[model samples]
Target: MRRDVTAIVRRRGAGHDGGRPAPRRHRAHGPAIAHSGVAHLLLAVALARGLAWPAVASQAEAASLAFPAAADARVEEERPEANFGADPGLRTDGGGDPEVRSYLRFDVGGVAGRVSRATLRLYVAAGGETADGPQVYRAGNDWREADVTWNDQPAPSGAIVDDAGAIAEEGWLELDVTRVVDGNGVYTFALFPQSGDGANFHAREADYPPQLVVATGDDRGGGPLVSTPTPPPGSGGDGAAIRASVETTPVRHGDDAADDAAVWIHPTDPGRSAIVGTDKLGGLAIYDLAGEELAYYADSTPNNVDLRYNFPVGGERIALVVTSDTDTDSLRAYQVDPATRELDDVTVRPIDVGIGVAGLCMYVSPVSGRYFAFVGDSSGTVQQWELFDDGTGKVDAAKVRTLSVGSTTEGCVADDGTGDLYVAEEDVGIWRYGAEPEAGGERTEVDAVGGGHLTADVEGLAIYYGGDGGGYLLASSQGSDEFVVYERRGGNAYVTTFSVTAGAVDGVSHTDGLDVTNAALGVAFPNGLFVAQDDRNGDDNQNFKLVPWDDIARAASPPLAVDTGWDPRRVGG
Candidate 1:
């Protein structure tokens, strides 16, 4: 005899609030009395037709209880026959071999719940007759398992599984499900195997195919959300208001494509600035602040050059010098008319002092108004040159001194306010020379700002005077796709370190040239620009980019917040 878990009440009479008990049926089995209400109903109806009670009861019970709802209840099951094969097209051999593929799918209804445990079991034929075993994978939302096991052993956790062992008749691999919390809906499944040797594995299209199951559970609340923090106030303080711009000057025998540039603001007329840029095969192309080509000189090969503000005999004017790595591989100087923005009618002369003449910096003394140029060679020797006016447009050069640097000297910069010069060696890092720009001078090696942060090819250097009386050192890490900045301490030591992706004007693609403008110049620069050049642009020559100083200052200050609650699954696969 079987009884229903829920009790049933019947209405007694008309307008009655309570119900009377329904009629009960009983039957006699071998030494046992069974209460069979459903059976009795069938028996009474059968008797009216002249049928026997025992026979009618037996037939009704057998017909009604053959299938139960509990027996069909959904339970997680593994389908070993649905294993995946390999692809033949990927194989090098002409013989078309198969591969391994696996998948998992299940529905958790629409309600949300934490997954307690999940597993997949794969059955393989013993004797290694099959090409490969089956691999398992999971596909769903908000479901994660920490330690997945295959054949009762821990499987690799991070990377997706691709290969499996050969399938043997008696050796079946069972994957243990660790945890899963699925929402309601239909899900799909897959199982693939990788080829063991050089054989190609192809998956049969009609294998396990795809299936969906339903999940039955109540919805739980959502998980916690995370976000990045906002930067602090006053992080980017009032930085120096330096600005600058570049114009292509036309010189005889020179291409209009300018490669490098230097700027000199008129001491008398600060509004009028003199710009000198290289014409590659030609001489120097001179321009005014308004981008007007004023004068050109056909003397030196203008590979790369800089302008010294006011030199001896120039008197409030500036001296222009360029590195001629193509011709004599020497540093050459020319005089410029500050008022007219023209090359002074002075004879040009070469300074034969620097070791690496390919890379040179012409720096003017802020206090004494004297001029000196530092030249770098391929052998990593830096030579200093002092300009002596010869009453003509050309000034005679004297060998100041030479300093031994690392191999491949690249970028050099001199701080007018501090009288300290910084040179970046391609492999060795940044080296600092003392106040006097003379040869064999007292030099201190600054701490290599980027140990792991920067890659091998460190290319450019620039300096920004911070509001707090210190300065910021910007270095282009060419290979690493990063531009690193360091805060200057007392001497060669840098106090803090940071980076800016937006300010990465040059190295973003392939940074080559970098320069920082003074406060007076920054104001004239469009939007307080700090300039960098990228030779790796579509063009062979360098193209300049402007970075807002305020953005750089902020990035140098502190870290910003980030959202930690981002889920990659809900967004996509």
Candidate 2:
């Protein structure tokens, strides 16, 4: 069924001459109604195979589904980095005055059976004309709609799926794309023009949004196809989709390599701050604000890392970065070099915590001005250690206390100003405990998996500090691909939730760890920055994504606070 060249079909004008029934169109903003015949066939197959039909589809469309573009945008060469994701129309030109290219992404994970047919349907805008319509090609799924530019746009990776001839009139253009789409997962496509006249089409925001008609292989009865609308936000999360502004270099290793990240705010130059991350399969890496690697060390398998500023080490106050070295069931420490923006190993000796290190976070006590590290394991054992300068300018630690979270756990963070520690129990929820060593093992549940605020396997936990004790607690709801936000003070009431969709960079998914700061980091992040470890990075290895805190604040339903008064340097003061 692989056709090197497929003719593009228009729903209007000459398209009617083919004698095939014209597909029904859904004009309003809602789920698409399916063709009756195709729906019957699909339902028969699903029932015969004992498969669970998705509730999103109606009775008439059970077999076939219509998906609107999950993310779409056009990039113009003239304005390389300018984003046109919100534009009503998308443009594509074949090396004209200013070459323009368009990209579209579709998440087909909901499609149950083998895909027999998939059609990319687009509506030509009224004022545009094309001597030769754009050609469709396969593309990498790593680019985001909100921020994709000509410079960062993914190049077409496969042969033309279809090419339209002359299109003098405006109408619906359908391109058959069954070859590249097989089963459930994210798929990206690129549209490139074949002539100077180029063309314009309605974007996802327009009334005539782009659509994909998917027919499962079980549908033997061929009939006209209709589209299904993209599903709305889940009940557990607010449907806010924020795009990442920057992404760190992909880890050298693949398959669950990048595990966690810690933001290091520069003492004098905030914009020059660095991100220290872990490659669980290999080692640790440091990256600058531009997402370029600054340094990397393959000394140990560090699972999680956290840092605290102003540590009395080596006879001078310095910033310290620490990690749970899972390779040796010990802790590893590094001294931050502001001048080089790199790390220097400073672990005095191998301090074993007696359990396999699964997660780790640093704490600077506001009451005693002491620094501590909480090291935890998959078996739920957590050990607290007090780190101090070992008179010889190296770092050493003394075991202080231990606790049991009662389940498989990882991802933890400590609020230096409030003396509070938050831990995530993978299949369970988040728990809060006093960070001070003497506070003991007593803990309280913050939110649970079925509580509507979180889903199973809660991964990373981060605190966004605001002015006068006003802030928010962010947790990575891994199972749902969303981030749940809660009020920082009071009972930590649920506030809102969001997902990192594609933008200037690719969106984040299955995030393992994340960190945030309210300290303004120059013009790029005047309010602050939020960094998350992205589990999937297209064809490359996993990486970290950076989102401006203000973007999240403004994108929320009631809007989050855009506070930038807190200085990370004064955490324990």
Candidate 3:
């Protein structure tokens, strides 16, 4: 269960007793928490009117009786704390008076259970002075609140209080404070409790006698709601779990570049994997898991890179294919070394059918044991390729069939389990073609029941199969900063939609490429990892991000994951 803070406020009503305008309300949700260390000082003006100090304390005890004893409460024997100060240079026009400012810091001990709401009670020891009212502020590091309060009927405008009323005790103000989860700075308030009625009372000077009291509430068992689901098993596991790492290109690189990535798991050794990433410019870089650059392939212009096992020519395994947006549209192949971890040679082959290629999808067919590559081109077409297995075990590219669809095709993928090809169009939703995509063969569009919200710029697409014989179609709603996951029912149709925003990752402003794999690239590799390219991190080139699959699997909400770190190098050094 995930619980969000619904509201944070200091006071009620449009203006203070003095007719000052009220403060604006702040409402936020999700993971982004705001924290400022600044303390807010709230002055309760009504309490200072000719009231004795001892009487103020008694009133506070009475008001506290309204609430029942907290189930998780434990009393701490520590003495109450206090701080006092004034700055002559502070001006009211600046929204704060330095001379009337006060600071109070104290910790509540014997915290027995999770705390949902905390209220502070302060008492004034002297009759001539008043306290600044309380305002709730947040901290960045820890979700703690530094609530400030003051004394007055209908606390001052812009003040953080629930409701302003006459102070029950003389010269003392009772403040009610709330906490901001993300705010990290102190909240300041101006303390100027009045000593007489509204028309006759004059504000006391900073040197006037003043006393402070602080009491905190411990309603851990019953208060506002605070809920968080338990994390999955072995997620933040001990040593030996392959922890995810991140790297960003030097800031000098072009802006918003890193868009997509392709990972090649060594067939013979699952522990090793190689990756090729698109810089969005014409450059292609290869990297290992350790954040080291192994090779750099510059095409002057490249679109995407994918790995596929073409025909095994001579008892060898061939698994490299790159798609380029060059004028002579073609799919390029390279010989990959499983042990040496290198792309030894490169080969470029034009599409056998005249449909120009735009994007590429490569995957090994689990049923056929043969490598299949699908090409999506600007011609609104998808072409299939049967990689020839040269005797030397090298893959020779040959045209299989071409399937045409709506204008401007963007992404294509072959489901290894079903041999069905999933294609995404720029305008329409996702379309599915038969195992063999051919000329004049119209592919069927998946039912748009829950797929209607699929954004206009749905550039990235991936599939996740569930054990219940159902699966998911994860589509990147690039323009919306949301990743929409749809449930795939029978007939390869999507039925429902859910979304998740990846945690703040540089360069991922607009997602372009996405991929997911359950096979372990190494002993520490997560069972499933979702990779996306960040277009907002670097200039001209894009960076990549790795999100844990388990997080996505368990999440009932959106599947957004945070980028753990940043590294720019291509291979592990």
Candidate 4:
């Protein structure tokens, strides 16, 4: 016997119907407590399936579709021709009555494009034989529930589409069907016993019905589904990498803490390149290629510095160094004197952060030819500003957006190639957030505290720009005096960890900030260099050390050898 199913067609951006509450399979045969917002349940369901929650800019833009069960039933193997499609409950497995397999079909359609996530929401009827759930397979789409029989039932692929290992037969169980949905059409699934026991799920006609939710994002949609990685702080590290090294005599500031730095590669003479560093207790320090301080700016307490090349200002293509001024709680922009390798405060106008300006980074949007600065505060709030000239020769910036990841945050970096922002939450881990002003607080913790990939108080984030938007993100694992590296593209995935061991000057530890460049500076650093603030250096005060990028890339086990050729000096070209 066959029964009719109450179909509910839901869609993203489609107006929701104020349908009254229906009894749930888990509850005591009655309406269950209602939640606040309808979108809340939908968002939770979408996230669990790894789908994009629609770009806020285009709230109705997420490629999403939901279809109600067209047919669902349990077919018996003993009576091959018998049809149980009208059963209120779906039974699976084999024991006394023999094998009982369940089949469900959803008329999925409407949306097209790459499916990022798909979920099969089912209501378990409970009291089914205590078994380890059943294995789900993509059954042939040619069968109809009303005519489906064991002997003539549609055949299922040998591939295991998904597995529900003993669902707690109480609440609604969501199964990941992202892999099964390669397109829009008759989506059918067969549930068979993985063991001799059984599990029964409520069929479509029951009070609680089955649903198929599919989430997709148009290729034109921005980066909402991209992934990144990070190591947790307060974790133990193993074997280290010993590579080329150079150390600078400690800074003279009290706590002379070296907070952050950026590499300034000379456009013409690569040998004349310099490294700009931040001194928390003091101001800014410019170092020559030889790791010696060339000039010092004592105007404000600078915490972090990042650079962008070919910034069009007054029709002159000049390199700009953007730094967070802790003393004035504002962003200070300096024009890089590429010829003399000195920094001159362009004043461009101070972008106020309202106090406590700690970490800083700059992002250049590939989609929009605009520049944005990300400022992180001690309170963990991150603010983004778009910089542009206000019809004057002076540079000006406007506050665009803000976000947070809890706890103290410092040392941030932006990938111009991917428009992704990396922020380090000292007590937590590094977080990858969309740099787009419209991109909300949907952040991915590239690393965490319990992962042991990073120690607590993770500080500083720098990305080595490899060509074609590929490279590595290096972080200051201050708690363990080591550095953790992750793939720069995708969700920052972990690569390996290494430390500046005691060799020429001393081992680098308790690092505060760091920078990496793929431009060859000199023979000593023929493979580019890594600059890190060393909290503890030789018996001297805190300072920054220079390590050859090659040593870290080839450090094995946890190594990352990347193309050392993304020259920032050629940016905007």
Among these predictions, the greatest TM-score belongs to 2
Quality of model 3 by C-alpha lDDT = 0.42
TM-score of each: 0.47, 0.63, 0.52, 0.57
Worst 10-residue lDDT window for candidate 3 reads: 68-77
> Each model's C-alpha lDDT?
0.41, 0.77, 0.42, 0.69
Off by over 4 Å in 2: 1-237
Evaluate model 2: give its TM-score. 0.63
Query: For residues 42-132, what per-residue lDDT tens digits would candidate 1 score against the true structure?
Result: 5334323433222211221111100000000001113223211221111111113332222333433323233211223222211223444
Arrange candidates by TM-score, descending: 2, 4, 3, 1
Between candidates 2 and 4, name the one with more favorable TM-score.
2
TM-score (C-alpha) between model 4 and the true structure:
0.57
Model 3, position 177: C-alpha lDDT score: 34
* lDDT agreement of model 2 with the native: 0.77
After superposition, candidate 3 runs with Cα above 4 Å error = 1-259, 268-271, 290-292, 309-311, 325-327, 346-353, 363-368, 390-394, 437-442, 447-451, 465-470, 492-504, 521-525, 538-540, 557-573
Best of the two (1, 2) by TM-score: 2
